[model samples]
Target chain A: MAKKKTSLYREFVKGLWDDNPVLRMLLGLCPALAVTNSAINGLAMGMATTFVLLSSSIIISLLRKVIPHQVRIAGYIVIIATFVTVADKFLAAFLPEISKSLGPYVPLIVVNCLILGRQEAFSSKNNVGRSILDALGMGTGFIFVLVVLGGIREILGSATLFNLQILGDWFNPWMIMILPPGAFLTLGILIGLGNWLNERKVKV
Target chain B: MSLLLLFLSAAIVNNFVLTYFLGICPFVGVSKRVSSAVSMGMAVMFVMTITAAVTWLIYHLLLVPFKIEILEYVSFILVIASLVQLVEMFIKKMSKPLYDTLGIYLPLITTNCAILGLALFSVLREYSFIESLVFGIGAGAGFTLALVLMAGIREELELSNVPKPFKGAGITMIVAGSLALAFMGFAGLI
Candidate 1:
């Protein structure tokens, strides 16, 4: 029983770092780059994605047996789209500012390879309990990366964090840190740092 | 002249890949080789043009009229999937050479967010049908341009590298950042 529990724990923990959807696996880079201009935007995008991922994983895992292998991809996409619509509507209704800033990206979640990749990879094969754990782990990792990235960009770009001034009067914002290029540059360096850390761990 | 401006703006001044970050998957995945990148770009351009036209029709004619705009995400995704499938079949049946050239890339286009993003942007902007079509072609062209440029750089990048950890995807991304910065120079064009 202990062994089984530990393995389940490992399943959940791996997604947090080792199999991180953004920094490590490099899945779902579009939104990771698009919406991370502000820390709040990143957090919002992450939460919305997690909602879709968790719901779809549950549904897909529950119906794994019923969904035919030949039509599984289509079925999975439909299920994902349904939940994405819910998340989109929820955001638009309650958080209109974030929704408008996120723009079509809320709807683009339907095609986020991370969510669909999870459905195909972990959820479809695993049981419901494990699928939920996996989704939570991946979602957390995604959110962590987004928050860090957004925080960095927000601070450097605007000298603020979450719209609050982090750097004082003497500090001039980098300006480029919040632009499209900054996103690519920052994410690139972050990925390299992740790889370096992994390499060091393996060696040690 | 306005339509021409839209085309130019979409193609360069407001490139989908660099500016909006729509198609980063293929921008990163298939950009290792210029040849395959060209083919993928062509396939995407073809499908995107068709998708723009079809999705516009479905939105304005079917969904809006029926008050089913809430089904936008679900319906748009389903339409894209089927359109990709149909286009794949039609190509395979009609032209052997063309099909062989674009054989592997067609299916991948279905999940490409750029196509879906184009549809949503057109709808959001309330662009007319012809404008949507022009925007689609232009976006596809911009995507192709970026992919090819990245591939060319990667080809050269293979020969010279400084750090072990920053190789491959890391370097590609930094290069993309530089490219984006350069592309920003075109901001004044429009």
Candidate 2:
């Protein structure tokens, strides 16, 4: 019994850094790279994604037995899309600006492989509590990376962090840091850095 | 003319993968080789085109008429998920060779945000049926264009000695950044 509990803890913690879906596993790089120009965008996107992931994980875990093997993927997507719709509407009606800024991305989360990946790989096989924990870990892992990228881009691009200017007047903004290419560049380097770290760990 | 502008805009002026950063998953994951990138690009284009046509019809015709636009995200994703599965099965039976070429990428398309984004964008922009189809195809072409170019460059890059900090993804990103800048030149087109 103790061993099972400890193993559950290990699964939860693994997603934080070691098997991070964003930086390490590289499963859900689409949103991690985009929609993170500012800290606020990153936080909002992260939270919204977390909410969807949590709900979908719970539901998929609960339905694991009944879902037909042939149609499990579709079943997972339908569950995810339902929650994503809820999250999207909740944001649009409540937080219009963030909704507008996120644009189609909020809806695009429906197809985000991370959520589906977890369902097919982890959630479908685990119990509800373990699935929720794994989802939380993965979601937080994703948010950590987003906030870092958003901080870098926002600080460098606008001389601001979290919407507050931090640089002096003489400082010139690296205008491209927050642009589309900047996103790719930031994520690519981050991925490289992640690889470097993982390689060092392996060497050790 | 307006439709043409949409095509030009989505394809080059504002590429989904390059400019909007919608589909970076496939962009980086599959762009290692030119042949795979081209095949993946073709698959995306094919599915995206079908998704746009179907989603547009469902959204404007069925959902809008019924005043249940709230179902947009749910319904669109569900349709896309099943459609991708159906395509995978059909291809396996009808064209085993093409299925082998596409490999795992066929089902992976369901998770490509660019596909969903195309559908959502079509609805968001209030595009008509034909307009949505054009937008879908254009987005796919743009994704293919960007992926193929990156693959071609990376193929050559394997032989080149890049700087340390920018060795792998860093330099790839910097190159993409510059490429994005170059693509910005197409702003004047259409």
Candidate 3:
């Protein structure tokens, strides 16, 4: 039953595009949907999540040998929560407004399936370098979608992308584009659009 | 009166699933069956109530006093994990039927964001012990109501021919979108 083993580099590279957490796996949509109303907030959340994710991945990868098999998920969660705390405190102290706007979401990252998923799926199996790459890839992939979502919502909702007025006054903002429902509707359409694009690509 | 207002706000005006997008995993996963949804909701409610009290004590008595507010996430998570464990044992020993239905879901609650969100919200709002407890209960009830209703609707949706692409998560999300739209109507209730 000896099959070929893909290199660690491939594992890391795969998460970036081929199996992007948000775009493909749809592992962690809570924060992806919640904080993406504004371009800046989305960016901040993405960076914060990436920091915790990368740090936790490194730690979990390093501790892969010591941690017991049954308790792996619990251990990964503890590690994730610890980094989330660090990130949350840094945001609260350095960027109070963004921290306030994000609110409980920073702490809520502890339960984010993405961090836990990476720890189980990639970090535990790979070396430190590979784990770091995997986390970076997934985090960047996540940020890619976040930036796009934020850009779309911000542009449509405020007639501005990244808070600089893009459209003239003649363009009316779809107030719906910035609220909770907008997050659901936009993501729903995006998923459908994503499937449509994939189907088209398959046809081509 | 203020307590009632808080309950109404958490339960109706600011629903955990509909408004905040918390505990969506089970909301979508276990909500396929009405009975399972009810049981899962009860399990979540039970764990969330305990998480509220425990996280409150941990944050105030330990983290704030020690100026280790940075440890909030770490501590809350540990507390929730242990809380789920304690809940599981208590459920198993207390009632066999309950353990049968809710046993599986209790373990799953450890990762459910709603419980964590409740802890984080109470801490962020600086809710008092009583208010936090009430908030926990209300949020749990709200979660249960949404899950049950969604399960009922999905049961009916099984008969209808939803397009293939929108079958699983796609339809659930669109339904959640409409449910979210419906819940928005409760904004005026506050």
Candidate with more favorable, higher lDDT: 2 or 3: 2
In candidate 1, what are the lDDT values of residues A1-204, reduced to their tens digit?
Answer: 999999899888988999999988888899999999989999999999999999999999999999999778789989999998899889889999999999999999988989988998889999999999999999999999999999889998999898998799999889999999999999999999999999999999
Per-residue C-alpha lDDT of model 2 across residues B1-190, encoded as one tens digit per residue: 8888888898999899888777777777777789888988987888899999999989878998899998888788888888888888887898787788777667888888899989888887888889999999999999999999999999999899875545666667667777887887787887
Summarize candidate 2's per-residue lDDT along A16-129 as a digit string, tens digits.
Answer: 899898876777777877888998898899899999999999998999999999889878888888998899999999999999998888888887878888898899998999
Better of 1 and 2 by TM-score: 1
Candidate 1: misplaced stretches above 4 Å? B90-106
What lDDT score belongs to each candidate, Candidate 1 first? Answer: 0.91, 0.85, 0.85
Model 2 sits at an interface RMSD, in angstroms, of 2.2
Clashing pairs in 2: none
Model 3: lDDT of residue A114 = 81
Better of 1 and 2 by DockQ: 1
Q: For every model shown, what is its TM-score relative to the native structure?
A: 0.96, 0.94, 0.91
**Winner by TM-score:** 1
Ranking by lDDT: 1, 2, 3
**Per-residue alpha-carbon lDDT of candidate 3 for residues A156-175, written as tens digits (9 for 90 to 100):** 99999888999999999998
True contacts kept of each: 0.71, 0.71, 0.50
lDDT of 1 by residue, B1-190 (tens): 9999999999999999999999898889889889878878887898899999999999999999999999988888888898888888887888787677655556767779999999999999999999999999999999999999999999999899559999877888899999999999999998
